[model samples]
Target chain A: MKIAFTTKGREWQSEMEPRFGRTDYILIYDEDKDTLIIFDNCEAKSHEHGAGPTVAKILIENGVNVLITGNGPGGNAIEVLKKSSIEVYSGAIEMSVKEAYDKYKNKKLPRF
Target chain B: MKIAIASGKGGTGKTTLSVNLASLLAQKNSVFLVDLDVEEPNAKLFLAGELLSEEPKYKMIPKWSEESCTFCQKCVEVCNYHALLGIANEILVFPNLCHSCYACSELCPTQSLPMFAQKMGTARHYVMPDMELIEGELDLGEEQAVSLISQTKTYVDKLLLKDTIAIYDCPPGTSCPVIEAVKDVDFVILVTEPTPFGLNDLKLAVETMRVLKKPFGVVVNRYDAQDDRVFAYCESENIEILAKIPNDKALAVLYSKGALIYHSSKSVKCELEKISCFLKSLTCKERA
Candidate 1:
């Protein structure tokens, strides 16, 4: 299963963005392949509204099974994510993407 | 003529000016005071009127049809509002995010997404002595004020006739609802105060009026003789200061009691008269 984290930069050391919808990039971790995919989310960041649903769509399109981010998605996006059956975990706002990933692995992060 | 009273800042006396001006205007001519601030419409509270009719307002939202078979995700792709979600056998529709644009419904390949009228708000008509009041109030948690404002305007338009004046008590701020309120009006009256927050919002309201190319003026409410920032700003921008309803404790007391100040207060009446004179100069186009 692949997991996604909202982030500021493309690397593993990048700061985990506090904003889910307006995050600069969505870093996808393919656990099976041990590969990382960076999805630029600049358009969603500048969107006037519905950024959450837009990001949710991005997650679905990228086959993201888990969404690990800070301050999880809002109503509209969360509705779509929940309907799509993608598990959302938040509380990674204070850590880096790698740190957040490790926390997820260790079951330290909580489901949103 | 349709004269919209708007203020970028809240509590700048848009409702007070609206009710009083409509009252003052109704004495000589037919008047309609429409409170388009659907979220918190309170103009009816100040008027002693009988309820004529109350009607629910609806806006079209796309409804997903599962029986139509093709789950090609065309409805999801065309929805600009991101209100639609298509995954496997089901297509989720989030009505709150829907702008009722009809793009998704119209573009759906198998006609699975059809438009449905969903109740969003209500229009209550109240008949007073000389004037009438029509205000739209949105249901709690409703997302778009612009749609309801437009719906209210359309409802009001049907009730209006030639040579009568319609005063729109618009929502606060220089946002979509404010735009929808003032966009088609014959003139715009921007209510403001002398304080910094008032002036800052006044500038934004002024910019909004300018952008819409609407003939507009300013009405400084709760005016203090001490602060002249609003005056200075209006002069620099070449905007007419239509009236200045003084900062009076009596008016506040009356307003808090849900009483119409102009009916009992001389100072407020004087200011409303001044605003009336300016409004009389502008003419509304004859109905076809």
Candidate 2:
């Protein structure tokens, strides 16, 4: 399964970003292979409107099955992700991507 | 000739200037005053005229026929607004998110998606003996402001007489709605106040008008010579200062009572007449 975390920086040690759509980077972790892929979310930065669904589409195309972030996705993004059966978990603020993944694995994060 | 009255900041008296200028110009020429501030239209409050007609405006949105849809997701791919979602063997449509571009139906291979019009707002027509007012009012929670503005302009275009002067009372800010209101006009009158905020927004509005390549002049509303920033900027830019309306308590009281200050105040009437004369000179030049 592929899990994605919204992060302020590209590395795994970077703190989790509170925003889902406008986050600076996205850290995707492959749970089966134990590998991580960092994606720069610079395209969404200049979006004046509809950034949420645009970011959600990017994550969906990347084969992300789960999303772990500090804040909840917007209403439009939630609708898109829910339609694709992607699970979204919250409560990752101030934590690293690894820590957020671990919390999700242990069922400690709240589902939004 | 068409003139658009615009301001980058809200409450800078765009409507006040629009109504007064239109009233002054209508004394001799045929004038059509269009209130394009669909979100919060207040020009109607000050203009007293018999309501002639109200026509609802509609925008075309796509509707899919489930039985004929092959679930190819072509419409979803073409939809830039994310209004269409293709789920497990089914497609979902969000009407509010649609921009009425009709791209989805155009791209549908099977032609299952059909186009339909949705009611967005109303265009109202009010007429006095000399001047006519056409205003667009968007329905609450509707997001298609540009479409309604364009529709109102189209309606006014058909009714306009030859050599008539049309004045558009535009909305605030240099956003899409403001562009729609001011685009393709003969001239733009930028109404601004005398303050730091006013100067900043005036710069923005000037930049927008420059990009639009329209002839524009500045009007300093509530002008106080004590704060010379507005005048200084206009002088440095070499832009024309058409008129200066002095800040007065009586003007505020009259505005609050939805009254036209030109009707009771001689000084304001003279200033607006000066603006009307300037605009008339432009029209004369255009004719010559």
Report the number of clashing residue pairs per model: 0, 0
Q: Candidate 1 residues B24-141, lDDT tens each?
A: 8899999999999999999988889899999998888888878994888887778777677776578888898889999888888788888999999998999998898999999998
The residue-by-residue lDDT of candidate 2 on A46-112, one tens digit each, is: 6665567767877877898999998889887787677677889988998887788778889999989
DockQ of each: 0.50, 0.24
Clashing pairs in model 2, backbone N/Cα/C closer than 3 A: none
TM-score of 1: 0.91
Model 1 ranges off by over 4 Å = B284-288
| Candidate 2: tens digits of C-alpha lDDT, residues B1-288 | 899999999989999999888888888889999999999888889888999999999988888799999899999888877687775577767677788888899989888889998899999999977799999999998887999999999999999888899999999999989999999799999999999999999999999999999899999999877789999999999999999988999998999999888888898898998898898799789879
Is model 1 an incorrect, acceptable, medium or high docking prediction? medium
Query: Which candidate ranks first by TM-score, i.e. highest?
Result: 1
